[model samples]
Target chain A: MSKVPADLRYTKSHEWVRSLADGTVEIGITDHAQHALGDLVFVEVPEAGRSVKADEPCAVVESVKAASDVYAPLAGEITAGNPQLAAEPEVVNGDPYGAGWLMRLRPAPGALAAAALLSAAQYQQLLDSEGD
Target chain B: MARQTPLFRLHQELGARMVDFGGWAMPVQYSSQIGEHHAVRRAAGVFDVSHMGVLDLRGARVREFLRQLLANDVARLKTPGKALYSCMLNERGGVLDDLITYYLGDSWYRLVVNAGTRDKDLAWIRERARAFAVEVSERSDLAMLAVQGPEARAKAARLLPPAEGSTALTLEKFVGRELGRWFVARTGYTGEDGFEIMMPAADAVPAWRSLNSLGVASCGLGARDTLRLEAGMNLYGNDMDESTHPFESGLGWTVVLVPPERDFVGRAALEPLAREGSPRKLVGLLLEERGVLRAHQRVLARDAAGKDAGEGEITSGSYSPTLERSIALARVPAATAGRVQVEVRGKLLEASVVKPPFVRDGQSQI
Candidate 1:
């Protein structure tokens, strides 16, 4: 079973969101997403200065089997993108929650609170409902 | 639920990640696909390829029947146990499947075909065999295991009976012979020295366990695909199918139109095309930049003025673990040459065209 941290928020598309001290949010794929994708060989994260809408494709993660898109969970302006992933993509497979975070974003006014992100329990339930 | 092979339970016991392959439950990987690929290149690896179809043909007219059925001349297989690779084509010159035929005796020949196309191939072969009175027998009771690498044969031979083990050591390449209850062939799909052992289905589990005990890495279908791509071998469904012929699929050499008198199923249709050049040609592409290549991606060929010259498609592409870079087999226009670009994720990446067999004998070839 994949781990779902109670402190984080998730989306139906499998991106996890963590609010930060500087009013910014960190984003990455869930453990379940990485496991389903097997070994990741390449990753293309969105650039910093780009404005992305909620539920829009903003990044790409490719495994040996196939490539998948990473959707933005909330309407936000990208502040920083993961730099280490370009040189070592497998870090996403090894530590998806920590060093493998894909990007950082500054949400628009009230966007984080208004977004329909799932709580940890709700995300776990979503994963359980869609069994492999 | 998909159909399960005899080794299905063993695969599950090994904690393999199972997926549906051509309506059959098969393992895509046990742990790391890259690790399994390296094991086959450096040491040894074993694959349970029991899903592949095994057919036994018998009758006094078997050779004559095959001559008209296969693209390669079966008369070349003069020695018993010798093998010949050929493509079975439709009357329209389109490839139905590629298979290996082993001459076991005067009236007996064994063929191993792709698992996905077995049903269609059998229907076609049986319908044609009626004229020559050839009997087609499907050997579903047998299981096949491919043990491959530089050390694969030695480790596998240790498990056979004492006398058979000695005989296996001397078995020549591309030959298969019955030893005790097993038919061992010195052949494999991976570009490595190995043996494909076929035995009674009941013995499959024990043999697999014994090989695991001998430290042969159990590989899944994912690794098998990368290994064969690096070896420059073609996959039946991906490389060519009912809509494409052998000439444009890098298999023109496998077809023999030399003895013009000898006729085959696709000969009449292929003769005219042979006189004229094919429009497309399959070649290897080496990515000059960072990224992964995948099947069905458009290949953009350019002229000296950097204008659109022609467009091709990647038939099979993946990250090659041996070369630590991306490689692919593409069917570009015959006139396409020099530098090309592969479109990936809405961006065109630079690449170079080269001959295939990208890596051979555990070494880089290009």
Candidate 2:
């Protein structure tokens, strides 16, 4: 089973969000998503200043098996992308929740409250329901 | 539920990622697909090919039956233990399945066919064997393992019985010999020196474990596919099917058109195709970009005037671990030039057309 960090909020699509003290939020695919994708070879992160809606695809992650879209958990304006991924995409498979963070976003006024992001416990339960 | 091979439990024990392949619960990879692929090319790797169908044909006129049933001339197998690769075709000259037939003795021959096409191939062979009084029997009691690479033969020979090990070491390419309860063949699909061993199903796990102990890496179907594709070997369903013929699938060499006297199953349909020349031909594509190439991607060919010449489809494509580049096998117009554009995820990327076997014997061919 993959680790579900208790500090982060998650989406059913597998994206995780970490709200910063400055009102900005950091986002990345969860460990479960990375494990499913397997050995990331390429990652297309969203650019800064781009607006994304909740549940909309904002980035792409590709592995040897297939390519998958990374959706935004809540509507926001992109602040910055992880520039380090262009050279080394395998970081997503290694430290998915930390240095492998996809982007930083400035959330819309009511987006975080309106978005139905699941808690770490809720995400863990969801993962358990998807039995091997 | 998918069928499980004799080594299924062993695969699970080894932490292989299992997948449903051709109705069989087979390992797609253990740790990494690229790692397994490199192991096979650089050293040695063992594959559980037990899901492949094995059939034994026995009759006074077995040779005659195969001569009519297979596109390749089985009569060429005058020497015992000789194997021939051929395609079984439908009446319309379309390929039904590609297989290997080994002439074991005067009246006995063995065939290895694709796992997915097992039922259909058996039914077709049985239906045709009736006239020749040949008995087609499926050998479900056996399992197959392909130990492939530069050092594959020497490493695997150490595990066989003494006398059998010596015989296996001396076996020539494309030849099989029965020793004790095992049948060892000096043949492989990875474009490497290796042995494909067939033994009792009960011995699969033990033999796999023994080979693993000898520093042979356990490979799965994911590596098997990439290795074969790099070797320019065709996957039955991907490279050709009922709608495609050998002429267009880069398998014209497998078809025996000589002596004109012998008539094979699809010879009637293939005759005109041979004379008139096929409009489409299979070619290799080398991607010049960063992205990976996959099957079913559209390929656009252009003429000298920059106008559309023809369109093609990638039959099999992947990021070749050996070359560290994306490569593919595609069916395109015979007149297609070196340069073509492949539409990948809405972006047209330029690619170069080259002869296949992109990497063979751990060396790049293109």
Best by lDDT: 1
Which portions of model 1 show Cα errors greater than 4 Å? B303-308
Off by over 4 Å in 2: B303-307
List, residue by residue over B1-366, the lDDT tens digit for candidate 1: 898889999999998999988778999999889889999999999998999999999999999999999999999998999999999999999999999999999899999999999999999999999899999999999999999998899999998988899899899999999999999999998899999999999999999999999999999999999999999999988999988889899999989997898899999999988999788888899999989999999999865556676999999999898998889999988777778999987899998888889987799999
As for candidate 2, its clashing pairs are: none
Q: On residues B119-212, what C-alpha lDDT tens digit does candidate 2 reach at each position?
A: 9999999999999999999999999999999989999999887887988998999999998889999999898889999999998999999999
Kindly give the stretch of ten consecutive residues in candidate 1 chain B with the minimal lDDT sum.
B301-310
Model 2: CAPRI class: acceptable
- Please provide TM-scores computed only on chain A for all of the candidate models, following their numbering: 0.98, 0.98
TM-score of the B chain in each candidate versus the native B chain: 0.98, 0.98
What docking tier does model 1 reach? medium
Error of 1 at B207 (Å): 0.9
